[model samples]
Target: MGQDVYEELEREIALFLRRARAISKDFARAVHPELEADAYGLLIRIADDGGARGTDLADYYGIGKPTVSRQVRLLEELGLVERRPDPSDARAAFFCLTSEGEQRMERMRTARRERFQQMLREWDSGDAEQLARLLARLNVLFKTPLVDGP
Candidate 1:
């Protein structure tokens, strides 16, 4: 309701993002010693989406096609992902995790979840659910224009 409240929220969100970036790097290394931190998210997206086209990934992340292409190339080289021909489009291909990639990502996700549970062990389950709901709402808000302050 107050300007100070918004300022505090902004500060907390910034801190949370910074911490998340660091944790992402750690997780990426856990998956593969040579893996870059940014590619870790791409792996998760492909695994979750079942598969995705390079252009679709670019659009989802609001990044350049070239950037997504480079990451996909690296994933291919590492044997973490494979590209399959799109049945509908001769010129396009869909990326999906290879069996090796699927296994590694699954293990990493399980560990990450366990780590989160440990970190939140002191909080009640209801509080954790409330935090998840608030975060989901915040993510949805990020896609739309904010209302002007009164």
Candidate 2:
């Protein structure tokens, strides 16, 4: 890619990240008045993955154990999450969303999906599908580690 193209891509990604952060904060606040903005992603991950351990979440997000533990504790205090003993490991526990959490997450997801549909209503269906596919591919690229360059 040309220098100009690379610069444009960087700019767009930066703007997207800003907007995403705002949206995530809003969504978390809507879910629970006391929900912390940074904890919103953790809630989503737990909901989507069914359940996960604090260590697992920390590893997945490339964050520190204390950070994940603090968020998980907050979620527990909010009554949005509960811990269940790991069937395979007596000493380990898995954190899962409560019914309230599931409902809140579903509502948030539905609202976001509707907003996305409205935003793309004027576009051709194929174009929207293409954008989704490309974004998914981009996410995959982010998840993959880069090899050392020569």
Candidate 3:
């Protein structure tokens, strides 16, 4: 109702993002000592999608093709991802996680889930579900330009 509420929300979101970034870095390193946090995110996307084209990845991340190229190259070099020629497109390729990559990512994800469960152990399941729903709504709002609130 007041500006204090908005200010507190901003402060809390900032702290959450900062801590999330730090945790992401740790997850990336656990997957591969050479993995960067940004690349680690891409890896998860690729795995979720089963495989992905470079162009698709760039578009998803709102980044340039060259930047995605560099990250994909690094993943390839680290033996975490492999590129296969696209059957429908001669000039395009799809990237998928290697077996080693899958195993490492699974381990990291399991640990992350366990940590979250422990952190929320005292809370009721309904509260956790509500938190997830609210976060998802906030993320959807983030996609559009912000305007002054009434």
Top-scoring candidate (TM-score): 1
Error of 3 at 142 (Å): 1.9
Worst ten in a row by lDDT for model 2: 141-150
Regions of candidate 1 where Cα sits further than 4 Å from its true position:
144-150
Clashing pairs in 3: none
**What TM-score does candidate 1 reach?**
0.92
Once fitted onto the true fold, the runs of candidate 2 whose alpha carbons sit more than 4 angstroms away are 144-150
Residue 70 lDDT in candidate 1: 94
Q: What's the candidate order when arranged by decreasing TM-score?
A: 1, 3, 2
lDDT, candidate 2, equals 0.90
Error of 1 at 16 (Å): 0.5
Against the unseen true structure, what C-alpha lDDT does each candidate score? Answer: 0.91, 0.90, 0.91
Quote model 3's TM-score. Answer: 0.90
* 2 versus 3: better lDDT goes to: 3
Worst 10 residues of 3 by lDDT: 141-150
Each model's TM-score, in the order given? 0.92, 0.89, 0.90
